[model samples]
Target: MKTSAADTPPRKRVIVLIAAGLSVLLLAGIGVYGLIQGPRTGPPPDNSEADGPAATAAPEDGTQTPGRIVPVERSSDPETFARNVATAVFAWDTGAGFMPLDYTAVVMEVADPTGTEQAGLANDLAAYLPVREAWVDLRQYATTQHLEITDAFVPEAWATAQAQAQPGQITEGTTAITIEGVRYRAGVWNEKPVASEHEVAFTVFVICEPAYDTCHLLRLSELDNPLR
Candidate 1:
């Protein structure tokens, strides 16, 4: 007695099921990441027992010090900053073939120069670079086959990012650090090229660092908005 063709199970059946399952999971994860805005900021107050007379000492430049937050104001030329940002933008690959770990930044040109505050160059750079960087890698994990594409951020990239984003968020962590009537804010990020040029962009915010630079993404967002 020997086994025949009818005795064998279909190999394609299992493969087909796995492929379909992967597709569903990938789509679901993307939806969750984008749609779910997570928790929200609420309420205010509690400055009564906040202790002693607050010091009005400023950094002489503009940024507020002696607090959890600080406004970034160490930016020179937007064009040059963009170049430095490019190094950081592509520091970490997005796993997609379009942007792999071995990606490089090729500056085509810079557009829309936003200042260091409230939706300017600095803000946009921070938002787009850092967050997008981690997001890109993390996204690929839940992408399809759970293939962990060699995710690693390079040094030059990180340094370049720091230089470009740091100046934006003077106050690393606070909301609306008393400033002019510009309603200015700052954040830092590690953004990637916006699909085409691959130039680093920043996001602007109204507050300095969200959490003492713990949340340095406001810069990236600010860099993206507001006419510098």
Candidate 2:
């Protein structure tokens, strides 16, 4: 994808609830991630289960390149990483020769690293691969995309998992865990419609190795409401 920066159009904006399709990103093993009204604070529950492994302040790769079409650097800060990821999820460039693999590669870069802990990145990738292929096949070209972080809050499930996780161990296998409250828009070029616009509310689920210290994207899902 070698789209010219000048050819990029101003993002067209609209507002609506996220579609059900994105919610299906989760695998059968884990149910859809959801959010509660307000933040919760308390001691770890007796039966609380955690996801993957505990968070670690691992050194981030200091790689940078000009003219890079996609972002692949894993960040030390999960919130910062999430906001950047929200943009990537919504935006694409057909002029730049963007492909589905390019999009998913960036996604994997921000996903929890797979190793001894079994963060389930493989499962998330498996679930998203088909959707990515379908998206590239359907939306042949996209002119512009945009994302806004209207608000952000820890989902109740993730919060609980964090509380329950041991100092060096992150809870794994829970169906809940995500950062909710995002708005997105994109301008797509398709043969049938020729051109189209999409706007929706969505969330990004992530795994934090040590509670909130370090995290990575797990999956993206649509939300009925902004959940602000």
Which stretches in model 1 have alpha-carbon errors above 4 Å? 1-78, 95-126, 129-223
Candidate 2: residue 173 lDDT (0-100): 23
Q: What TM-score would each prediction reach against the true structure?
A: 0.19, 0.46
Q: For residues 1-228, could you state the per-residue lDDT of candidate 2 as single tens digits? A: 112334322211000011222232222222333322211123112101111111111123442232455674455465666666666655554334555457656666655443312234434333323244334433333333445556555555344434533342333321232344333223332222133323345455554433223565655553333222
Give the candidate number with the greatest lDDT: 2
Query: How many collisions per candidate?
Result: 54, 15
TM-score of 1: 0.19
How close to the true structure is residue 26 of candidate 2, measured as C-alpha lDDT? 28
Residue 101's lDDT in candidate 2: 59
How many times do residue backbones clash in model 2?
A: 15
> Candidate 2 — which residues are off by over 4 angstroms?
1-67, 115-142, 160-169, 172-199, 208-214, 221-228
Candidate 2, residue 192: the lDDT equals: 26
